[model samples]
Target: MRPAGKQPLQSLYFDYPLFEFRQPPELHGGDMQHPVVIAGAGPVGLTAALALAQQGVASVVVEKKDTVNDGSRAICVSRHSFETLQQLGAVAAFLDKALGWTRGRCYYRDQLIHRLEMPHSEDERFLPMYNIQQQYIEQFLIDKTADYPDLIELRWQSEVSELKNSADGVSLGINTPEGSYSLRGNYLLAADGARSTVRELLGLRLQGDNLPGNYVIADVRMAHEFPTERRSFFESSGNPDATVLVHRQPDNIWRVDWQILPGDDPDDAVRENNVRERVAAILAMIGHEGEWELEWWSIYTANTLCLDNYRHGRVLFIGDSGHIVPIFGVRGLNNGIADAVNAAWKLACVLKRLAPASLLDSYSPERRGATIDVLRNAGKSSRFMTPPTRGYALMRKAVLELALTQEFTRPFADPRQVQPYNYEDSPLTTPEAGAGEFTSGPAPGAPLHNCRLDEDDYLLDHIGHSFTVLYFSIEARPSSELAALFAQLYQLDPACCILRITGAADQVNEDDVLVDASGRISRAYDAIAGTVYLVRPDRYVAGRWKSANPEEILAALRRALGGSKP
Candidate 1:
């Protein structure tokens, strides 16, 4: 992937405006009622608020802190995440400041073992992933909230102290700098990070595997010419029987994660001196001898955990509050972003009365399924990066040895990265009649690819935040049934839209149409004339029909909105 529209940027934390703690009128006196009350202002909560705002839904964001995150929390934003940000109106700032990369190299004992290239093509707008600090991720989201002043309100230094869930709504007791307050919402979103107060109040517990291997992640600054790429070192002379990972970030900073020997205290590992020593050893091993300064450091053990359910009455959990997967493939925040997107759209539909309450029930299964899928892949990467047992360590050593010499073994060194999960079995999706099994292009429950629809924007810009009927009609004129189908969508979802795409300009009519002059959208969908695709508000294909039938589309729309097809 190639970087585009590169511009110099200052520190995201320093350059962006700091949010101030707004004094709320004693909510205990019943001063405010938010339709949606979100519990956290981190990346997940901020993204959830923005997603709600984009869908014309109002929300209140409660942050325990007055500023964005101060560390390089999550540095890799996947391509699908970029699309979601685009839908939520926060991608331009991210692209301007992030380091986009597609290639990674794996080394076993100083010998190149494998070179991995993620799926990237010139046709795509954003790179497969971008490396930016979590501070920027939160800052960009905060900045975008300004565009929807009426829709999103951020409450800084406000912590959720208590939560009461009922059939009608959820009431929250909040703690602020000024005084204690109370608030109520029709629905509550729990995005308060891994130590979620909402989850505690709901009495929900996460269950998953916990590995004993520990790792120390440090962010250091230095001037060097190494391009942006992920490099993993296995059992190097600098750290025998341990693995170190090097990832480049913006602002001349790099993220270094290395395994800590058993019985090493995590407190001692994050000490500046200990971190500097480890950085020096890895830097020397990687052939760098620059004067380096340690910026920040943290430590953690490998654990994969998730709640039994994501939704509880009027309260819903999102992001890390709902699940925690090993960070082997950068699935942590990326999956959290997916959570924000998924929950936001469904909440919008139910809030707008466009779907049944059962629609929101699918959020748990679909996203939890996604979390489990991530665990399955990330578990593999974790076992390789930090073997949990002696037998696993021996197997990894043997695998590394084979990868060093055998080309066939190199693919095992892949980090897999983050991919949008297929929701073929989602209750909200029509059962796939072999559509999800397709290898050529998108299947039902697959992600919609961005393609140049005209000289100005991509096809994805036309989809999202509402049900979309993408009817592939090559002719300039629309048929009566197509027009009827378009009309029906408005009745079903007021936010819904129909993108009438055609390769011929002469066939375009008064209904605003998109000209797929390059035929990329058609190729990406493998569509023909009269083919129709139903896209959910979250940009996943709900169903595809060889022909546009209004009744069939209406039935599919019902199923997508959590109603059984009649």
Candidate 2:
């Protein structure tokens, strides 16, 4: 572990020649011509590759690990992230093996403090969160990538030892089992884990500290009688030196974690018989004791750290390389997945010449801002889990006890506190006053609602293909001349897809401004009588306007297309 400071980089030295003598093979197909190369076969890298392939851009992924490790880490995926995966065609495989949880509870000592029933809508797609192992996500991504041919070459056992970047692209020196070889890519994405070799080589600085807390994580099969559908947390009894958390997986397996004192030897505490004793103690605490089998056990130190920047010229970082938050909120993996989705499309646009290079600049500010928000939220959740002092613990307990009441729980049910994020300051967002608000006239930065089009009941599924524009009324529709101009623009820009939703259509009345498939339009979007909304590829509202002014719409499109003159 290196200290937190600017350290001089060490030069690379090899005992043998860097590469065995061989002629460089000629690259094949437009896929191989991609400028970006991702190093790591983790979920973030695989998601990025999948996103790029879906957009018709190629990428190469190199992994030192030969196979995906079936460790049950990163077990929770958010609704937004699940939708993003579905867009890449990887969610079906994940859903086949995932566990859906619509309820969560918090316990303090012998009292149930907080209980939350997940949101349910007439639309089933937005129901519950999914829980699946991180490895499953990686495997699903790898399987779906077959459609892209050789766009993503997963060279197992290939390790990147050195990296060099210039104004053009990145040059990587990789050491493989056979021999060493050099790879040149227009861009490099570092989705490697926390101790990233790419970040170290680039001399990038991680911004936070490794907070003082260590815990032991164990995956075991317990033959005891306990609720398998709920997550349980137990506070320390009389002694603040210990705490326990248990999560039950869909496969009937249990994941148990116990907090360790500062001087505890984690390895010694995880002995076979010792593990059984700990399980027995926990079961006894809950008044159940039975036979149990241990599958795997390990210790980890929790830290809240983030990189200062997500991009440096052609080399970009995602996943743990960019930020790592406390696990209480289950935000780390979900945040990384979001980063991959955001970067993959921009990289594809740049490679295909559909959008200018300036589009890549949005990755850092948007993701970094989101990362900061995750840190703050995770920090709050962590404090709720492990209060700093006796007074804090008492306060937390009181709050949770109060939250058990219906009146208090109703306010806490607002998912917006967890789901809302802004890309308003992003370089890609158009500059308009009150762009961040949900106004009627075409203003940039309006979020996408789960809405529908005319004669269609499934708008969420249809809107996933590409960027979309929806008109709320027939009067808001662009004139024939403007429609023709937009048709040309859509022809030139393969990333933007347009759809119209109007009151003149079935199930809609003239009084209805914006009617979703389910006919539920809240005050969130204001539902103006005659207005149009422009959504980005990632589904954030980019621009909205009341008038069908083709020139204003074209100007907004130009700004979104990377600051080009319309």
Q: Pick the candidate with the highest lDDT.
A: 1
lDDT comparing candidate 2 with the true structure = 0.66
CA lDDT, candidate 2, residue 384: 50
RMSD of each: 4.5, 7.9
Q: Show the lowest summed lDDT stretch of 10 residues, model 2.
A: 8-17
Model 2 scores a TM of 0.83
Task: List candidate 2 stretches off by more than 4 Å.
Answer: 1-34, 222-230, 236-241, 284-291, 388-420, 431-447, 451-457, 474-478, 503-525, 528-530, 564-566
TM-score between candidate 1 and the true structure: 0.94
Clashes of 2: 8
lDDT of 2 by residue, 415-524 (tens): 22245467776666666534444544324654465533334343556564456766554555567866785686586566566655543435454332344543344233
Q: Name the weakest run of 10 consecutive residues (lDDT summed) in model 1.
A: 1-10
lDDT of 1 by residue, 1-566 (tens): 00123122233223545567777665436466678999998899989898888888999988888777767868999999998888877888998999999999999988899998999876688889899999888888888889999999899889888888999898898898788888888899999988898998888899988867788888778887888999888888667668898999999988889998777787787776677788898888988887876667677777889998999988888999998888888898999989988999899889989898888999999999999999899899888888878898898888889987788778878998989999888977765444433344567788887876555577887774688888888766577876776777788898787877787766544455777777877788777788788898788989887666678778889899999766
Local distance difference test, each candidate:
0.83, 0.66
Per-prediction TM-score: 0.94, 0.83
User: Residue 429 lDDT in model 2?
Assistant: 68
User: In model 1, which regions exceed 4 Å deviation?
Assistant: 1-18, 432-439, 453-457, 507-511
